[model samples]
Target: MCRWMAWLGQPVLIEELLFNTQHGIVDQSLHSRMGAEPTNGDGFGLGWYGSGEGPGLYHSVAPAWGDANLRELAGHIESPLFMAHVRAAIGSAVQPTNCHPFRHENWLFVHNGYIGGLHAVRRDLMLAIEPGLFADVQGSTDTEVVFHVALTFGLREDPIGALERTVGLIEAVAEQHGIPDAVQGTFGVSDGSTLWAVRYATQGPARTLFASSDADAIKRLHPDNPRFARLSAEDRLIVSEPFSDLPGLWHEIPQSSAVTVRHGGVLEHQAFTPRVPVSAAHA
Candidate 1:
């Protein structure tokens, strides 16, 4: 598995989330307390929206903790919405193209779990991607295939629905191949304004996911903490794990749920289950 973090709120230094906290994303890259693997050294990537561009991406087939370029960039660039991912490479090659925070136009996506039986269903999944989007697939990872499948099902128009359809398709193919527990993932996607995050697993157990408490509430609760006080209510962060040691500042996103954060900082959570039909064999 991998570890990732997504930020949406007032523009702040990228390092604030990547390196400054007690167990920031950078720290997690080297010593994740909750991930199945302690060290996610395969590769890393960062994606952020720019002033007038779709999104800017910085990816390297280098460990996040030791990459000098990433350190330099994190120190220099700042965006109100951005995503960073450190890879552990479940069954994929350790290549730049396979790095997370994969981008398409304005959308950015990252996943923190593997597709069960990926190799077995790779051919069917690949053939299912729309031709135009299929040509854009540049990596041999199940994560990339999931992204393309979402695009094929109309991610731009309906992100949640698209993703549900993609998961359904993947599950269907897995069942046909007699593969059990076909999907296992905690995923996050954003389009610079709205963010959609899901914690789910076909086997009913998924990786950890968390979202920061409301900035205003935290500020009120811990008036002396300058860090929390500095943030506006509009600021929000969602990560694979808590970035800091603040006891009440983080809340675990329940398993089998989805969280959506809007531009104005309103957050909503709901039960999330693949709406597509599943076969008994697949389950």
Candidate 2:
């Protein structure tokens, strides 16, 4: 339904990942080979942390490929951590607020998935968002709601735990609405220091998710490449698809799994299951 990428590590111009990579998010916007749709032209968004208080956000209803502003911004902004996404609207309207890479204070989140039968259960899900966090709901897309649900469930405290709760609740509600196999997609979230990416679906396999190997290892493997030398060992990237076909550069995240990327580039993989269990996620 969408395509996204999150970068955490050495500071680099946004262009390095958004535009420079062979199959960067920008390219994927129009020529996506892995997304459910080949083109994610509905909208786009960019969230990055600089020397600011929180994070900087720029969103638009324009296709990423045709947005001159996006190109210019990417060329100018350099960040150690950021998230970007291109949308291919499924059931939501195309609006600036509905774009991915949704933000809240110091956190940024983006997803490439769908909540099955969202319309049928949207009201219940929205009502479930903690009233305190519910005020931030500015968009009408299920993706935005998912972000808030995670927040309500305590994403600020534990990204992995909160998300498991978030998904569990959604599936619980979906089942009540008679929607089977209610969730599908890959999700990425970060708080400028730690990053979490999840791949999951209620029934069949979820969409694709991949993480890059240590950049230093890449440099050693391709010593002749000048680009590799500029990368730091701490550089890490989690993407919906490989940026390139370079051997040993990317590893696919397992189904129903999550990757935790710490500030120092330490990577941890773990089996992520619905905390609420299918039949008892709800009281």
Candidate 3:
């Protein structure tokens, strides 16, 4: 498992969440509260959208807490949308390509869980990826494979559906190999605009996922705080755990559901169930 976060709202320096917050991603890299392990230091990555058409990405095999480059870069880059991830290798190599917030065109993805019993099902799942997308698979981590699998099934057009399909296919393959409860993860995905936080598992409670309350909700909870007063309705932070322990600041995402935050404060929290897509159930 790993720890990660995604931000979508007004432009702000990356360090605001990466380091400056009470228990931000940088701290989580060293002391994650909800991840399977306390330290996710094998590798780290950051992806953000700026003036570029596709988003910029930075990755390293260094522990995030020890990466001075991450410190300096976070202070300089400001983005309206960004994702950061710190990895903890379960059964994969600790390398650059295995680091997350993986990018493909304008999209970036991060995940906090792994394919249960992957070694048994990896081959079959990899073969299911469409040939065109199969070539873009750059890392051996299950997170990267999940991203490519979603792309293979139209992630660009229907993110939620594509993700569900990915899970469905993984479950199908896992079952064929006599593996049960084969997937667990909270995926953070974005296309340089809308951000989606999806939490689900094949047959058990998924990993912990949380999202910052919208401006109005925060204001209602903390009316006297100037910081809460100044927030725009669109400001949102989705993370594996709360950045701060402040009550009412973070809302736990319901299991087997997703929260989609679009431009202009459009928040859609909907139920998510992974079903074998009729089109791929037999494939």
Candidate 4:
């Protein structure tokens, strides 16, 4: 239902991602070939970490392609780590609060899938949130709730575990409501220095996720290509689809998997599964 991209490595003007690529995020806003819905015009958001305490956020209830202000900001901002998302409303209001890369302290999250039967079981999920974090709930979208649920489950300490628990909670509740295929999405979360991306579903294949493989190798093949100049060997990208149609440049993350991107250009992949809490049965 949406398209998003995250960058980690070298600080470059945001337009290099928002506009420069052949089919960058801004291009996907109007013609996303891989998203469930091709047009993600409902709203858009950008989160970037500069020389600040945390990431800077810009969200608007306007299409990414149509917003001149977003373009202006992208041209000026340079960040080593950042996320950009273009949204397609799925039965949710097109308000600024509902647009993503939702933020909590220094963490930012974005999703490209929906929770099934959310209307039937939203209350159950909300009540599952730790009271301390529940107070931060600000919108009606499932993505925002999922982010908080991850936080409630100790995302600050273990992102994979928190998300496993988060999805487990979503699926367990969906099962109680007799909802089929309870979860389907590719989620991306970052804490300024590192990024964690997950692709999972209860009964079907998770949504699309791909990461650029070995920027250094790509640079060797096209040393004159300017895009490769600003990026370090460790700089990598996790995107909803291949940023461009370059052969062997994008590697698809396996189904039910998580990819972690850290400094020094390191990327690690691990199989992922939901962790059903013992208390969930009683809840």
The positional error of residue 222 in candidate 2, measured at the CA in angstroms, is: 1.2
lDDT of 4 by residue, 164-221 (tens): 9899989888988999978898999999989999999888778899999888878776
Clashes of each: 0, 0, 0, 1
lDDT agreement of model 4 with the native: 0.91
Candidate 1 local distance difference test against the native: 0.87
Q: lDDT scores for all predictions? A: 0.87, 0.90, 0.89, 0.91
TM-score of each: 0.96, 0.97, 0.96, 0.97
Residue range 1-283, candidate 1, lDDT tens digits: 8999999998988988898889999999999999989999999999998697798999999899999999899988988999999999877789989998889989999999989898899998887778888888898888999998888878889887777778888888888899988888798999888899988888867999999888878987899987877898788889998987767888999988899988767789987767553321244
Q: Tell me how far candidate 2 lies from the true structure as C-alpha RMSD in angstroms.
A: 1.7
Off by over 4 Å in 4: none
State the displacement of the C-alpha of residue 272, model 2, in Å, after optimal TM-score superposition: 0.7
- Per-residue error for 276 in candidate 2, Å, reads 2.4
The candidate, 2 or 4, that scores higher on TM-score is 4
- Runs in model 1 deviating more than 4 A are 277-283
- The runs of at least 3 residues in candidate 2 whose Cα sits more than 4 Å from the true structure, single-residue gaps closed, are 277-283
Quote the RMSD, in angstroms, for model 1.
2.6
lDDT preference between candidates 3 and 4, better one: 4
Residue clash pairs of candidate 3? none
Point to the candidate with the largest TM-score.
4
Per-residue lDDT of candidate 2, residues 1-283 (tens digit) = 9999999998999998999989999999999999899999999999999999999999999999999999999999999999999999988899999997889999999999899999898998888778888989998888889899888888999999989988988888888899997899999999988899999999998999999999778987888887788888688999999989888899999999999999777999998887663323444
